[model samples]
Target chain A: DVKVTQSSRYLVKRTGEKVFLECVQDMDHENMFWYRQDPGLGLRLIYFSYDVKMKEKGDIPEGYSVSREKKERFSLILESASTNQTSMYLCASRRAVETQYFGPGTRLLVL
Target chain B: DQQVKQNSPSLSVQEGRISILNCDYTNSMFDYFLWYKKYPAEGPTFLISISSIKDKNEDGRFTVFLNKSAKHLSLHIVPSQPGDSAVYFCAASALMGAQKLVFGQGTRLTINP
Candidate 1:
């Protein structure tokens, strides 16, 4: 089974603080994605990486950025955490055109 | 703009009954559709998927029906169990999108014992 692990299950940060959410996959999948889930809004993609050092902005990438320095790890960076950024963050990893496996998710609370 | 839509925000069903969840898409280019289940504070998990070529796909108690002409699909769960209660998100991807999925707002399902 593919296993995707996130850095934290819950995170808290103050306003204007930088936040980092890490994700690692054991299956060596080349594709990884980050999404923030909100009530009545579903899951919106923040960013995705197709390969090492390759990244692309998704539909809702406004206040988020991502880094993929290695094939097994993907990182999401919050430049300046705001209250609006408080939400459940999920990480998913997949092979080309395959089903995406997701981590447990991290609930971020920016105060 | 909101390519995928799950109109029903919530549904309640009695155990041992059938639960039908519907999804619609505005983009005709979508060739792959998927269903995912998510629990509170957890990431969405892949439930089932269907390709445009097939009208129906079934696994265990879950069946996915696709209607290409209407650009719609539905997920049917038979003998619904309390554990089946979760938020279900419908997602779609165009063949050339490289698996970038557009997801609906999701439907929260509840099963009564």
Candidate 2:
């Protein structure tokens, strides 16, 4: 079975603080993605990395960035956390246009 | 502009009844359509999928019907169970290789026993 793990299931950070949400997939998938889920807004992609050191901005990439240093791990970085940035952060990894296996998700609360 | 739309915010059905969740997409170029089920605090899970070439796909009690002319698709769950209650999100991908999916707002499904 493929397993996708996130660094934190729930996190609380103060305003202006820098936040890092990590995601790791054991399947060695080539494509990884980061998305933020909000009520009534569905899942909006923040960024996606198709290969190591390669990344592309998605629908809502503002105020967020991602790092894919290694193939198995992808990291989402919040340069400066703000209240509006608080939401359910989900990470996913897929291979060859197949179903994207997702992590449990990180619920970030920016205060 | 929303490409994928799930007009129904929520739906309720009794056990052993049928639950129909609808989704519509504006982009005619979309070639792949998928459904995902999500629980509270958990990531969305793959439910079922249909290719543009096929009009219907079925897996157990779940059946997905696609109407290309209407730019719409629907997921039908027969004999709905309480365990099936979750947030159903409809997604579409235009290009096969460019697998970025546009998702709908999602419909909360509740099964009353």
Candidate 3:
């Protein structure tokens, strides 16, 4: 079975504070993704990394950045968190076009 | 523009009754379709999927039917159980390799006793 783990299950941060969310996968998948889920928006992709040091912006990537320094780990960074950034964050990893395995999401609260 | 759409925001059904969820896509390039089920505060899980070449696929109590000409797909759950209640999302992918799925706003399904 594939396992994807996130650094935190819940987090709280003040406005303008820097935040980092980490994800690690044990399947050695080359593709990793970050997504935010909202009530009416479903799951929108924030950023994705196809390989180490290779990143691509998804539909909504304005306030977020991702790091893939290693194959097993992917990190999402909020340069300066805002209240609007409060939401559930999900991390997924897959091999090429196969089914993606997701980690239990991190619910971030930016106050 | 929303390429993938789930018109119904929510659906309610009695336990042991059949539950049908619908999805539509506007992009012709989409050749792969998938359905995911998400619980509150958890990541979405892969439910069922159908390739464009095939019109239907079934797994236990769950069945997926695809209508290529209409660019639509539907999921049918037989004898719906309370545990089946969750948010269902429809997703599409155009590329076969290195695919990035485009998802629709999910439909929340509830099973009433």
DockQ of 1: 0.83
Of the candidates shown, which would achieve the greatest lDDT relative to the real structure?
2
Best by DockQ: 1
Q: If scored against the real structure, what TM-score would every candidate get?
A: 0.98, 0.98, 0.98
Alpha carbon RMSD to native, model 3: 0.9
Per-residue lDDT tens digits for candidate 1, residues B1-113, read 89999999999999999999999999988998899999998888999999998999999999999999898899999989999999999999876766788899999999999
lDDT of 3 by residue, B1-113 (tens): 89999999999999999999999999999998889999998988999998888999999999999999999999999989999999999999875655788899999999999
Candidates' chain A TM-scores? 0.98, 0.98, 0.98
lDDT of 2 by residue, A1-111 (tens): 999999999999999999999999999899999999999999999999999999999999999888999999999999999999999999999886678788999999999
lDDT of 3 by residue, A1-111 (tens): 879999999999999999999999999999899999999898899999999999999999999999999999999999999999999999999887678778999999999
True contacts kept of each: 0.84, 0.76, 0.73
- Tell me the lDDT of candidate 1: 0.93
Interface RMSD value for candidate 1, one decimal? 1.0
Task: Give the better candidate number (2 or 3) by lDDT.
Answer: 2
| CA deviation > 4 Å runs, candidate 3 | none
* Candidate 1 lDDT by residue in tens digits, A70-104: 99999999999999999999999888777888999
Docking class of 2: high
Using DockQ, rank the candidates from best to worst. Answer: 1, 3, 2
